[model samples]
Target: MSDYDYVIVGAGAAGCVLAYRLSQDPANRVLLIEAGGGDGHPFIHMPKGLGKILFNPRFLWPFMTEPEAVSNDTGESWARGRVLGGSSAVNGMVWVHGEAANYDRLAELAGADWSWTHIRQAYCELEGHQLGDGPARGGKGPLRISLSDYRSRLTEAMVAAGVAMGLKRAEDVNDPEDGERVGYAPRTIWRGRRQSAATAFLRPARRRPNLTIVTGVTVDRVAVENGRTTGVEGRKDGAAARYTAAKEVLLCAGTIASPAILQRSGIGPAASLRSLGIPVVRDLPAVGANLREHRGIVMQWKVDDRLSQNRDYRGVGLVRSVLRYFAQHKGPMAGGAYDMGAWFKTRPELPIPDGQLLMSPYSFDYGAPSLRVEPSGGFNICVYKLRPDSQGSILIRSRDPADPPVIHARYASDESDRASIPVLVRYARRYVAQAPLRDMVIAETRPGPEFETDAQIFEAYRRFGYGNYHACGTCRMGSDEDAVVDGALNVRGVQGLRVVDASVFPFMLAGNTQAPVMAIAWRAADIVLRESR
Candidate 1:
């Protein structure tokens, strides 16, 4: 058996960062286990390559949620990164901190350790912002944050439209002191290339002899002994292996696998485990509960064929697009799919923005298995409720780690969430109808102009809805009875076991998760290292 001071499972966003941070102490030997392979594929680096990687098994886990009535009995596709950088390698690459209120709420749930004042240090510690040491934004951190230089007629038009409609415009999303209003989001990109956790944090740490990265390994369960996790047991490339941790084991397998691995290790709901003939180590029912994700709808509109990038991808220009990426790294090849965004309230009384709108310069065939951007010419708007009432769960089907668990995303199950759909649509439609966006629109392409009735809108929402892929809350960290982990991020009812990924979030963040996930891991490392004293 191989042994180390700390065993971090899943080399995704948090896992990679935790390994990097913990191994800083030369005496602490850290091991990172990942089921996925390497992050060397060129598609993984290209910003616009996400459309090609969405359904590809090489980069991400192919997860399909159970049928939900809210989505019209359709199973939504869940694309989770299976690679070293985790979802950060395969995500939108947009870096958003959401609003300050979200972090304040986390403080209420976790502790003062997660409050904004203390949390700001971690934010600054991890980000290298474009605004060289602004009062609100950090200048030097492992992750390089830069603006996407790519442009499109539709992207510029959307920005113009946002200004025309009196929406809040911001140059920075991380700063609340300068009025953290929303606008076109920035990216975790550096000079036109993707900068994921793998590229930023893990890359530097990999050269450290104290840190070991074992890819193509499936972490089956936490190796628990005498109520404490000593290490982990899993198969690496079809061969069984055991690795012990001298101090503690941190679960960074993310929302889906983290809970499933917890249950497989006998730390979840006892009754549920016994049903699958797996012995229970703990009766913690909350291990896989409180599953939450944003419900989103993709609305497409037709534009003049000459105005859309769709023409660039059609025939002979496809070769040129590829060459453009290799030469300049910008053009249409550098797209992170989306270029502009807006955050606003669904109603005036709400304290925070209840809805979010993201404008992608290209539209795709939503019904297809693969994301094929419209070859002719068009763009899309993804509308999501910032805070939703809907909730669901993650449950293991059997004791086998190879069999994927069932993800009941149950999006919009709550009536409140259902009611907000129309408001979100109306808000998005109104924004597009203003200024240059309306001028560029040939017509409402998909739902068409006829879908106006409340009932009709709800139906359209169900038909077009897809998982926003921001799932969180399983194995949540809190002091409450239902919390899977306590304020210290230690798994309740167990010693020397911790969870340090998005799975531990009590509630999801308001914006894209990549930025916040890395920040959380940075703080987790501080807590784990400090408490060891």
Candidate 2:
């Protein structure tokens, strides 16, 4: 008398993959639920339209973090996608597989199943690269990977500058073997449209009768009975609704929502649950702990009008770009966020690149009330620590599931993270000062020439640094008893539940997280299938 053999919550990157893979078996009745509406927005498909729909609450959960000392005691907006494809539909479209060493570390913490070898094989099976298939690349998979279509003299100069600084030029930056390289970034964009997880996986699976998709449903919590998750309880169309799961309930609700959902289900820290007047099922303290994110600061330079794309984003130029995009699906309107990218070591003694830089041909005045392209000619170079040492937490604000959780993003709280800022700024200045870029001769617009000393540079970062939106490690997986999930991703204290997505990452990776989240879900589906049989 079960409604579905498997109930998958949140149709984001991980949820979409799980729904598709699990439903392949006709006997398994799968149900996928999303809190937000569909992904049919015109802006969602247009690669450059991210700036338009990113803050639109209709498509995302506009979660804001709690003010902390490190961030100058000011709360910042955190965007998490609520639509069918989730953040993948709203993200920057950067397709990075992360470093093999990071996954090798996961293998050491969890098991061999999470090793780089398996992850590489999964990438080979999951990607459809524009650059033809080979030993290291996959050309026949569902997700399409293409190089940035937008190119400019400024972007070329940026790459040349990296080469002039001794960084190796890589054909494919996604290649794990290419260490500390610079190149045009690969993206989840194909023929000018965003290749979101819903577009690649869930949409195709919709034809299957066994797969059911429900939107606008706000999941409250898992309905547990005798220490096992029987199903989920939530509100649909302003009425209470419950769905039973015959096999298991998979939580793919991302970092923020996954831990919150578990806490609501009476499965987190015992004292906190009791204080909220909720019955406790398990006393797992790590449910909403160990939050991590990449903190970054943007640097801008006022370039010559001819080399900048500022005009292309405003007035008559914008209208022309729009017309061209609708007619031919080509132009600045179809470009990804960062066209040129690089990884480098801030300190020469470091073994691998400790810092990452992303360059864009266009610049935005983020201090304004609304995000708009700068009226003047300019370009941006953003820098971030690859692996931040600071840790934070997510806790339920109240017993109500409708209330947004409190996000304590303790960014740069560690002394090392603070010290790295000056070094990173110096490295960025050096890169822009090299070769042909030096001739471009643009004055530094952000934290300009006045900020000279290390302390001044650190203060500049403190004033301008922002999260890269790659939040993870909330409900980390490990062999330790305090770990929320086991090596196979099963809830350690629950009988019929699993946490799939970036929340299960033991630590943050070295790059954008969308690609890694999808691959992890693909592997988790295999584990679920194997156990079910």
| Residue 294's lDDT in candidate 2 | 88
How much lDDT does each candidate structure score?
0.83, 0.89
Residue-wise C-alpha lDDT for candidate 1, range 338-442, written one tens digit per residue: 777777777777777777888876777666665566766788888888767777999999988989899888887788888898888887789889987898898
Worst 10 residues of 2 by lDDT: 130-139
Candidate 1 lands at a TM-score of: 0.96
TM-score per model over all chains: 0.96, 0.98
Candidate 2, residue 195: the lDDT equals: 94
Return the top candidate by TM-score.
2
**Model 2, span 12-68: residue lDDT tens:** 999999999999999999999999999999999999999988878899898999987
What is candidate 2's local distance difference test score? Answer: 0.89
As a whole number from 0 to 100, the lDDT of residue 33 in candidate 2 is 91
